[model samples]
Target: MKNRIQKLTAIKNAKKVDAFLITSLASLKYLSGYFFYFEHGLSPFQLLPAALVVGVEQQASLVLADNETQQLAFIDPSISVKTYESYVYQKPIDHTTQFLLQLGEAFKQAGIKSGRLGVELNALPASLAFFLTAQYPAIELVDISAEIAHLRIIKDEDEIASIRRAANLSDIGQAAVLRLAKTGMSELELFNLVRREIEESVGTRVPLMADFVSGTATATGGGLPTSKIINDGDLILTDFTPCLNGYWGDSCSTIVMGTPTMEQRSVFNLVKEALEIGIHSIQPGVQAREVDFAMRQHLQAKGNFGHHGGHGVGVIYHEEPRITPYNTMALQPGMVIALEPAVYSADYGIRLEHLVAVTNDGCEVLTKFNHCFQQGI
Candidate 1:
């Protein structure tokens, strides 16, 4: 875990702002040790605390609802916590006004009256934005959401370890899918089988997403499993995501239900070659788009391909430093990316994906799942 003070200092240096108001759950968890209930279980809507205020000087303050005060305190006992009962009306006595007033007082106490106040506009609610602006008219509000995202792009030791565990879980799920895949099995059935194995192996239910499809339905390339059934000589593609400790791992592989046709084998080999080219292209200082170009060029030469070649994976399955033609950011050490190269056709489709970590010299493949096209039940 990164020290809250170190994160705040990085934010201050990057954005040149006096302080940042973090409203994003992921960002809040990254800075503070608080892991909210919503992140662990299902809920109608995510309950977000008002805001976590971090100043350039390492000062920390949490503005939360009355119900969350104790929970936040347990997460960080030494931090200053302020509570408001904005929506908690069941209590005989409410501290809503007190919370907002204390928050304003904290700002005043910190001497942050007339400098740049960074806000996460993408994640900040409109109502909260209105209240902050109304309360602090002298402060200049700046959108620093991208600056925070930049901080999360590179993986630290702990973050990488979490992702590695996620990758191992995903590999287990893929192996289960490969073992159960057979002719006459519906895509949904195969998907559920993999889900069951993953939960059983982990000893608890976690967030696991699997997509299994074959034949013309495979034209979609990637999506949730449907009711379509597998048939002889059909190409089955399974893309899996397994989450561990708020981190994610993504990998995809194409399989043949029975015997693969010569045409299917040809397309699968082309995709495998393209994937190899893309993986070999990954290294520190290499442009992200160049990898996409190499994979796309290989597929286009073969006369079959898809739109996006690959993407970055982490806290969010799909995040920054996207592997597309539009991205120009250079790859750096500690960056983890998901590289997928696919070739789709009217009859069948083929795709192979792996999680890779960018190193000081080159890149290392993190996923060890089998990608054999000849493998069967």
Candidate 2:
């Protein structure tokens, strides 16, 4: 994470800011190497983690609640940490005020008391924003959200490793679907089987999903499976996304319950070709749109391409450099991407997806699952 700070120092230089406040969870997690989860509606107002502050001249600090201070020992022992007490009605301590004061103190100690500051303004909560501006009227806070997001576009070594683990988990899910999916199984039953296998392999519950689309469900663009039973000759599509640690992995495979027909095989092959060609177009220094244009143009000539060719995958499932017609961002080493090309019809949709990392010369396929049409159950 220290290396991450050094890399982000360039952002400070580019933005002409003396320091930066990282409030976005994605950026914070990227800098701190810690990922925590809270219930949907129980965060911030009910619970909140600290924001990360980085000064060009000072060590980075994680500003969190007092109760979470103990976690600093494990989260990042070397980084500085400042904490404020949790809110309590009886105790009546102003936690927000405390956080602001502590944060201001951190800035003062870092010699950034009266300098321009770069911050993720979009992630800054309204209450905190009001308090911060009211307290530190002299501080010049510049929005650096796009700067940090661009820095995250190309992942570092540690991020790649975590993503590899997440990719492996997704492969485990695809394998489970191939092994457990059988004729006459309820769509819900298939969904449960894949989820059970994935959790068992991961050794703990995660925020993961294996959407079950079978028979007529395939034509509807996929969803959470129902009690509808899968039948022979049915097309089943499983788009498994497994959350391993903080990284996300995605895999989409469309398989048939029985021997596939000639038309099915042709469509699958066409989609696979498009996916492979897109992957082949990925290399350092190439415009990201070339891959999209090649795949979309090829699919367009043959039939129809309904989705973007690929997209960057990391802390957030969908991030920068989406492989779309208008995206001209150059592909760089360390960018992990997923390429999925499909042909959707009323009867069914056949899509094959693979995760790959851009290399200096070409790209490395991160997903190890066999996407080829399986002849037997």
Candidate 3:
């Protein structure tokens, strides 16, 4: 946490800002190591459960709701914390009002009264923007959304561990799909079994983001579970994404429930080959676009595919270091990315994704799952 604060301080110095107000929940977790449940209705537009205020010379201050004060006990002791009321019954004032009031106090405590303050304009709410200008007329609120996002692109050791665990959960989901899915079963039924298996493995009701589509639905890339029944030889593309320990894991696999046609096996092999080529191209200092080209060009004979070849993942599901035709950002060590290669036809589609970490020489594949479509089960 101290190292992250120092990096933020360096960004402040380079940008010549007096202080930085971080409102994004992802940014809050990245800096403070405190994970707040997203399902909680704290950040409903103008109200946020927490925000980190960093001054040029003083220690960073984390402002949060009084109801969430318990989180302070787990965070770094070097950082200070301020709290606003969360539950009150007597002539209650709005949460936004209390939040801004405490935020102003946090700035004052940091000795930042009048100077240019960095703010993530994209994530900052209109209510807070007005509060800053109204409270300090001379204060300059510079947009620093891009700068803050750049800070989280590289994963630390702790973050990689969290993501690795998350990937293990995803593998559990994929295995369930093969064991529980059968002909005549609705897509929703299969999905429920997979979800139950994953939650039971973790011993908790975990938040999940995924795509469970079957048969012709796979032709449209992927979609939510429906009443569509699985038929013999039907294609099931399961892209499971489960969040464990505040980090996300992503993996995609396409399989046939019964005997696959020659076309299905051919397309599946092509996608798997493309995924392998894309992973091999990943090395420190290699441009992301080049990796995209390597896979896209390999599948050129099979025609064009949809969506990006890959992207970075961590606190946010989809982020920078995007592997596309135009992205020029170079891959760096410690960066975790999900590479997905696919081919879609009028009748069906096939996609396979694997999570990996860019290494000094090449990359390490983190996703553990079977990627073959020739399974008879």
Highest TM-score: give the candidate number: 3
Candidate 2 per-residue lDDT over residues 177-212, each given as its tens digit: 788888889988888888887888878787776667
Task: Please give the distance, in angstroms, between residue 310's alpha carbon in candidate 3 and its true position after superposition.
Answer: 0.9
Candidate 1 Cα outliers beyond 4 Å, as residue runs: 33-50, 63-114
Which model, 1 or 3, shows the larger TM-score?
A: 3
lDDT: worst 10-residue window of model 3: 37-46
**On residues 1-377, what C-alpha lDDT tens digit does candidate 1 reach at each position?**
54444666767777788887777767776666554545444322223555677665657777766655446543455457766655534555334345557678667655666678888898887756787778777777889888778888898877777788888887987788678887787888888888888878878877876666777767778677888888887778888887765678999998887777787878888888888899899889989999999999988966647567778777778887799988999999989899988887766678899998888988888888767886543
Provide the RMSD of all predictions against the true structure, rounded to 1 decimal: 3.4, 2.4, 2.0
**TM value for model 2:** 0.91
Top of the candidates by lDDT: 3
Clash pairs of candidate 2? 44-47
Measured on C-alpha atoms, candidate 2 has an lDDT of 0.78
Order the numbered candidates by TM-score, best leading.
Answer: 3, 2, 1
Alpha-carbon runs more than 4 Å astray in model 3 = 1-3, 40-46, 374-377
